[model samples]
Target: MSCDGDQHTMQSSDDVLPPPGDIQVLLLTLDSVSLSWSSPQGLIGPQTFRVTWGCDGETSSTRVKDVHHLKISSLKPGEKYQFNVATEGEDGRQSRWVSASLSTVLPAPDQLTVDSVDTTSAAVSWNQSPGLDHTQHHYQISYRCSGTEPHITTTSSPSITLCDLKPATEYSVTVCTVLENGKQSQLVLTTFTTVLPAPDQLTVDSVDTTSAAVSWSQPPGLNQTQHHYHYQISYQCPGTKPHITTTSSHSISLSDLQCGTQYSVTVCTVLENGKQSQLVSTTLTTGSCPEGWRRFGCSCYYLSTEEKSWEESRQDCLERGADLVIINSEEEQTFINGFEPDSYAWIGLTDSVTEGTWKWVDGTPLTTPRYWWSGEPGGGTYQNCGEIYYISSGQGVWRDYDCTFSQQWICEK
Candidate 1:
């Protein structure tokens, strides 16, 4: 039994086949790149293909049946990857592996966030994309209002702060990362709105005994979108305790104030988002009683601790833009009774003009009967001035006394 030459030659040829060739990368994406190639020649049916790919000391492999194009995934961006492909026949025959090189697209950044934002500036930060390790990457940023040219800037770090933006304006910001090879990833985008500015020209317009009127001008050079805002007015008689009010009008009245008291007032802009602007302040003094005087009913009063003659006390009141106190009713008399039990104070009542006739210093006579202590005016000409039992008395009635007598006094205006 002798084997023929053709039979032996065909048996040797069936044992092995040629590998795939001329592998070409057709397209590249963020994570995976597509590849196409010429199929292996002289291969029979039921054949399998082997493909192995690697980048930067990492490798992965895949097997498929009779496919001309193979896709290698899990490849790094901005890097060179080496790929090898071979053909396998059902007869347990394998061809030599063919090698080629391809590169993937650069990866985009991850987790872009605005760390902080304000009226004139914003701070931004981002994380490096996957497979971007050990590569010197910087950020290129652009921002602009709608339908306008974008402003471009670059930084060597992943975070940046942008300044000098218009207040109360909306802007679109885009950030892209660039590798050392000048390849840029896909752009990431976000929207930003600057905060509103403070109210302008805050001023005190008028003041009264119990309140003051304040006015402010709306912020100038603002567009229609920014022009709408309400005002928050805050005031403090003392700087430590603050009271607030909100008003839509440009002018507002602050009430419930003590007379002759100074206050610091501030106005802030409240936006649609319930955000407030910086505080603008002014100082105002209400017009009423002087510093030490307290207002009661129609007049302001001041009590003296220094004892003086009735004439001296009355003269001091005149110089203080006031006059000596004149009691006309039971309530007025009761108010003056707040003085100490051991105290006595001079009033405007005096019979100085005409002896034995009681009169107020302003020429108003004591027209009412029983407007005196029981059996008062008994001093006649000697006791011309009048005084009151100012404190802790069963009756705070008047007692006629000599004008030259020195005592504490009350003044009014």
Candidate 2:
């Protein structure tokens, strides 16, 4: 071939009409289309094929690339479309377009099943897209409460579970097929919502000091989630406001309650949806201590006071169903001494008759002395008896004074 001056002489190669070979396009699957053609023997180089595809008469074209085949994707499922491929040559010459008309694919029947739904959520499961090539393309799933765009897509298995939805909500979900080319198929809506867990168990256990323990269990049901228990204890004293404790635990310790008092207790369970269970209630009793005294060591005794000498104080205690505050050890002696300060009283120990000797009325020999205040047991001519004196309220000191001197005293029973 030679080029002439203006529109040069170019040799015409019009004699190459190979037998018309079958060039057919078939819809192989939802995500894939096949284009097969017979290769004519005499071709100088690889052929460039362009495919035009679209739905509802809307057409789009792919640029020419050096390949005998081209695939069209992102078509709607159960939708129909037509496509044509054309060949081009080195000098920009083109071959006649080979066209084929076919429907993209039929959508698979959705696997619709109802799952448990709670006050705020529902759970749904469905079958995967059948038309998508298990190898080349993945799926994108979208859902909406109504007809709208921008659905949610997930690559997870055949099922998806949603959360944080409105209580008693109805949601519509659809899955679209996406290709590596970023094209997406039509939406396949799935109907599903999360289900709420069942009511939990409510329990209360009694504790000392007007206290009680409470606990609960998770609700029972499919897709149970975000379960918790809410608890409170309420009690009323005759003339006092009700005491309340809000906690998530099954038990709490209450203290400083009036003896012989009664209290009420209650418990409830809570769900992630903010729905709470029915509260259960029970009663408890606070036992009693004797009058004008407190309970300790399972016994009640009057914490009374008397003013008498060591012998007289002992006789006074014996007359009043009690005993002179016995000082078995320094601890008891110091305890009584500390009961009152700044006032002198009589305790059970005295060595009035014999110097350097001490004894309780009960004939117990005094081995230890607590708070032998300032030169105690001076063995001088004046001091003889063990005197209990108070330096302050609830604080006391001891001294050695004449046994007959009148002093205040403490009594216990």
Candidate 3:
């Protein structure tokens, strides 16, 4: 074919068909462009083709020789362009711009990216090369029902997120680049969705008078996999102070609690993404010792009779399946003194049946004696027996009363 004057003429059977060349315009991307064309029959065996393209009507041209494809980089986004191909044949050059006009695809969604995902919300962000000038562009960010969006568009913001989504649902999404020029490109798909909140099932293993053991399970939903949790517990026991502890494990031990008290316990789950679950609460009972056995020094002790001789007190305590009070330290003497009665009661100390040597019924030596009332145990001629009697003053003291005197003898185990 030839371009003579206004149009070209074709020979009978030979030049009837337009030159057989395949032309294609590929939008390499927003920053680059590629125009490709091939002639299965390029003149003869090893004939080469020259490809050229530019914005239609522009004087500048880019040329690629020999190869059938031409990749042009640094092209403006959203710009319309055209391409054409010519062959170097044995009959000199053949043909003019024979193919139709073509345009580059709008640049892939600019600044495409995900910002954040939460239990009930997701934050997405992106930036676009708004043509030659920087301006807010329109974008349609479509998301899958579960994960991140696969694509993005131009007219849309560099980012946008779908709201009010079900927790833990898988989603696919894409941003459609809507140009200010009103061109809508193919969808850019990305998959994402809102994450599930922490688990809600929490409970106490058991409650004691002063403390409770608590436990809870992870939330049930998507994204629970491959994630660990932290637990925070808060509780209150009657007549005691509130308490709290943090742990990765589901259980905790609480100690030093008051007896016969009602307690309230709450537990909350912490998601891997730093989200906290609702607090779960329950009521429990703290373990307590029996009545009248007030805990002192981690043990229970009581002076049996308000008034009894050392021997009498020992027998009384023995009848109750206990022993006459064993005084361990000065602190204990001070403690027992606080419960003093008007009359003297027998303690475990004694020098009866012999003289000048004190011994406990259990036969333990007194390592330390506390508060012996002034001028104690003056065992006169026959005062070998132990007697607890008040002195002239209000203070009480022990005296060696005769064992045969019949004064109330105290007994312990």
Q: Highest TM-score, which number?
A: 1
Q: What is the lDDT of candidate 1?
A: 0.76
Better of 1 and 2 by TM-score: 1
How many steric overlaps are in each model, in order?
0, 36, 67
Q: Supply candidate 1's per-residue lDDT for 257.
A: 81
Q: How many residue pairs clash in model 1?
A: 0
Alpha-carbon runs more than 4 Å astray in model 2: 1-102, 106-109, 112-124, 131-135, 143-151, 161-172, 179-186, 190-413
Measured over all alpha carbons after superposition, the RMSD of each candidate to the real structure, in angstroms, is: 11.9, 17.0, 12.6
RMSD of 3: 12.6
Instruction: Give the per-residue lDDT of model 2 (tens digit) for 1-413.
Output: 11111221222334233311345775466655776665544665566544556555456766445555555555655455666555545565545565667766654325744465555555566566575433355656665664445447566465555655643335776665565556565666656544433335545444333233444454443232423445445666667788776665545566656545676655554554565545566666655433555433322234445455666766777886566565555545546655553367766667765777876656677775466667766776656677666666443566788767666665564
Runs of candidate 3 with Cα error greater than 4 angstroms are: 1-97, 129-137, 147-156, 161-173, 180-183, 186-253, 256-330, 339-413
Query: Candidate 1 on 175-289: residue-level lDDT in tens?
Result: 8878777878789988878777787898888765677789988765454464567889889887458898898888998988866778999998887778778889999877665
What candidate 1 gets wrong by more than 4 Å, as runs, is: 1-103, 146-148, 180-182, 197-209, 212-230, 234-253, 256-267, 271-289, 295-299, 302-329, 334-413
In candidate 3 the C-alpha lDDT for residue 176 amounts to 68
Q: Where does candidate 2 have its weakest 10-residue lDDT segment?
A: 1-10
Error of 3 at 267 (Å): 6.1
Clashes of 2: 36
Predicted structure with the largest lDDT when compared to the true one:
1
